[model samples]
Target: MPSYALLRRRRSGSRATADHATADRTADHTAGAGPRRRLRGLAYLALGLPVGLLALVVLGALTAPVLMACARPADISSWADAARRAALLTFGILLTVGVAPLAAAPLAALERHRLRVLASAPTEPTAPEPRPHAVRFRARYTTARAWREVAAGYLVAVAGPGLVLLAATWAVLCPIWLAAPLVVARSSGGPVALGIGHARSVPDALPYCAAGLAAGVLGIVVLITLVRAQAALSRTLVEPRPDPLATRLVEVTRSRSRLADGFAAERRRIERDLHDGAQQQLLGLTLQLGLARMDLPADSAAGQAVARAHDQAKTLMADLRELIRGIHPQVLTDRGLGAALYELAEFCPLPVAADIDLPHRPPQAVETAAYFAAAEALANALRHSAADNIRLTARVRHDRLTVDVEDDGRGGARLADGTGLTGLADRVAVVDGTIRVSSPPGGPTLVRVTIPCPPHPQEDDR
Candidate 1:
């Protein structure tokens, strides 16, 4: 086993163990926390709005009965007595009707805040998982907050009695004022049968019930409207921070694309330089020697010199060939990625395998990128992985051309500041492709390349 392979295997084992250990620690913490969390909730409830509202309602109900009992007339035993109490009864009813409106005003504001608080709570949970639609307000109110909101509603109910009393008092006073003039006139003897004794006035039943009901309905409607408005306001205020992540993603993709184009362009320029400069010069020199051979005698000193030139030209040709191969191997263009990769595997010192499935011929750019990435990956495997074997697989599916370059060697491969794979990655990006390198510092190292399929003609139009 090579050193890199052994190191990779060790790293893989450690990662698995660490993951399990962390999970166990998390579980233990959660288990211990459950009971205490519940107790804190119960404590908040005992002192909170629910308790306050219960006490308020209890006090109101207890006082209401006693007050009503004491206020009732004891001498009213006949219809005539009932008529006396009628005034007080009318007063109470009218007061109740008048007060409902005033109570509704603040009640509406309270309802608005209640809904707003509810919506805000759910939104505050740290980063809920993303969904297709906008996040819904699903705030869970703590017992304390719920109680407080409900208790505040008591203020709305409190003003009810006062409103009714005001209306009833006004009703009584109006009748008395009208009767005062009549009573004075009667005292002056407008009619012998006329008297200034108290007369019961019939209270208007229609106005009392209609006013109270209308006030209640209006209050409820306004409350709902305000609550909805507040919810809208809260959403605007506390929305997710404008996610610049998508913009960053686009920028990164473009940057990668530019890097890819630059890398590819550089390789092409280098290849051209090698072919036009050194390779051309070597070919010319060989041709010149061939022509020189014709003028020299077989056994002559000139002939021997010609022979040496011929041999030198052949050696230089070989050197030129090697240099061209280094730039972009001939096999790559001649036979496409599959054959070129096989040639790469044969040259590797360690064991290697090729699993290639080409559904269709890819575009020239795609093939070129794949070729370079595969070659560079193989070189890295041979030099660093020290692995027993490597796997090279290529396939085209779902409008994407994918290639997987794997080595069973010591993992932990990073695109360092200066590395052949880094250059290869840049090249791959030119065709809107991505490269992911997963090499834990252990046995298996994998490099996956994915290039988006070129758009169809119809898609381009759309």
Candidate 2:
């Protein structure tokens, strides 16, 4: 039994040792794979270096002749020669500047393809707007994007290959040269050296060979880093920058609109809670007063008190209902903007003529903005305007809801005025809307608000 147990212990120890060896091999493989893959990617750029250089050469060839022709003597011997000279200068200028876009089409396309496919960049070149071919050609020449590519191409073509060649030579050739001396000494049993001095034996050659190998490995790493840097620069120079102010403005507007919607939702929630909870309690009180009155004599003080209590509860309940409506109307949610506006007009003390025409409900933010704007305008009219008649009109056209509130009153409503028009303007703007108040001094004041909605929603590129 003791011998058997000893054998079992040995087997377990051997298995654990084998597992550890396997893990060590895996770790080494993982570490080396990263550098190997990086080097492989670097090779792709090295191969591309020649193509870039060749493109630069082609561009130079196309542009150089034109330059030379332009520089040729303008004061020719004959009128015919002068005409020819003028034509040549024009051709050269046209080829370099005017037709440069056309000349660069193939190179730009190739660059875009390389970026998208090989380098895995979303560097898709914007297609020229479709028009007459001549028009398109002219546009391409003028386009900054196309011109930038030409500039980048010229830079890469001239310098890219030269850099790649130097890196490749350092990374590949030096190591081979260093190792050759050692290999020769080992094979032939003779002296060899990689030029620092003659190595008489393999031991003499070892240091030089090892130095070369280390340098080659380092060079490979450097080459990969350079390739990566070049790609980054290329991408930076090519991509167009979005307008900072415009993008931020859009983002801010959207954010504000979101806040406005949230505020409206919260208001609705509070309105519902009050309507459901408090209103029911008030109704129950009114009912209890009625029940208490029925059980008592009609002329009794308690009966009279009960009657007054019932009336007061009913009046209070009505006031609370109106308050809830002001907060966030249930009519607005159930019957849409038209019904809501109509209900608002009915409550106003002044004669309000409402003309609300809409096919569908707009976005919540837009609807809320429009509703509050109309309400504010009416309030302003009641406070300031001496007019008895107010006309409120809402119409939806061209994917926008326009609300107009006109009051005949002594008018001088400015954004400078602290009469809440400025706040209304800001609220309207949150949903990418506009508010225009034509309230000149001494006459009819009209507040018109236009809010965007539907078919064409606001873009959130920011």
Candidate 3:
């Protein structure tokens, strides 16, 4: 080992070297910052100009007639002219009102992408606003947010070209001005014209070069400021507005999911208790009764009583097993939804044609919901459909579980008419699933159930 003083000297050298390296890196970063920001500002201007021009063209085309109709001649002496102007105004208003919302959506999407890529802004694709009675056109098109987007689109169209023009003018002029001295030196002996005078040599162009350098620096500052302002405006207009109702709906959905999970866990607990505790006890009692009957005399009353008790005990045990299955099937827990469904088909009184193709099992709650919905639909078909054949098809596609049940029964099934479908609807709704009934009052009832669930990965490996 070296002496302590020597070691101290070596450590000090290392620290000094590290500090010098850090300082160099920082200086390099500082030197490059202006060019990087200038490039970013240029990119923003280039992108915004084309998008703004496109928006202007489209919006202008859509609203031109409306603007023209508003510019009616002061002299409306003829009734026909008045009527024509009114009709034109009405048509233009209707057209703009109808098409503006659709156009705004795509424009807003482009703006959002530009902001996210160029400004490094945190942004997300906006989901469509939810509304009740969405099937009606009025409900979908008459929202305030839709009009707000249209206004934003117009603003972007108008402002984009203006800002780009200013930025581009400064960008071109600054470079040309800064290179004045070089231009003067390269020119022929004849004088090159400056803004107010002529320069015959590089020395005479010094003032122009100084002015250009100053202007270029100032231009960079202005460009950065304008780019930031544009980004802020785009974000304000294009970003999704926070809706309290939507937020609350999301919270409610999460709470419902949690509750469903808790309920599923509780159901497993109950099924376990019955299977391991009560059902096992009942099985033991059943065996004891069978043994007691064997010991008694065949002709005596005690023997007959013991035999009857044994038969009743066996019946009760089977019923208890069925109850346990109804609560939560062991096959579902062990094998999967596919196996459980096929087993269910085996027990159905009617002939069931089952086609179940699942790559993997879904979540426990989803499986439970789907199984019960299928069971209910099958039961309804059997009791009321009055048809012979029933078909059941289940598959997992695009992260959704779709189960369809169809019957060739005398069909008059209706959800609101209280055919047990309302309960199924409610149950499916708890898991953010949907149930559709298509029984057109004559025959052939079809109940389609769709539940959103991603497949369980571990189950797929098995």
List clash counts for every candidate, in order: 15, 0, 0
- Listed in order, each prediction's TM-score against the native is 0.39, 0.63, 0.59
Model 2: per-residue lDDT, tens digit, 1-462? 999999999999999999999999999999987776665566557656766776777777667756666664745679898777778777776667755556566665555454443342345566644699887666676767678867766656765776677776685657665686547666666555454466667667777777787777787677667777776666655555465897898888778777887887789889889989998888888888889989988899988988888888889989998889879888887767788899889999999999998887776667777888898889889998787799999999988899999998888887768798999888888777898888888869999989887854333211
Off by over 4 Å in 3: 1-38, 60-105, 121-141, 172-219, 281-316, 334-367, 373-424, 431-462
Model 1, position 3, has a per-residue lDDT of 86
lDDT of 3 by residue, 2-44 (tens): 6998999999999999999999999998888867766766777
* Model 1: lDDT to the true structure: 0.61
Candidate 1, 300-379: lDDT as tens digits: 99999998989989898988776676677767656666787787777667777887877555665677788778878888
Candidate order by lDDT, decreasing, is 3, 2, 1
Off by over 4 Å in 1: 1-245, 248-252, 269-281, 290-312, 329-335, 342-352, 387-390, 407-419, 422-446, 454-462
TM-score for candidate 1: 0.39
Q: lDDT of each structure?
A: 0.61, 0.76, 0.84
Which residue pairs clash within candidate 3? Answer: none
Model 2 clash tally? 0
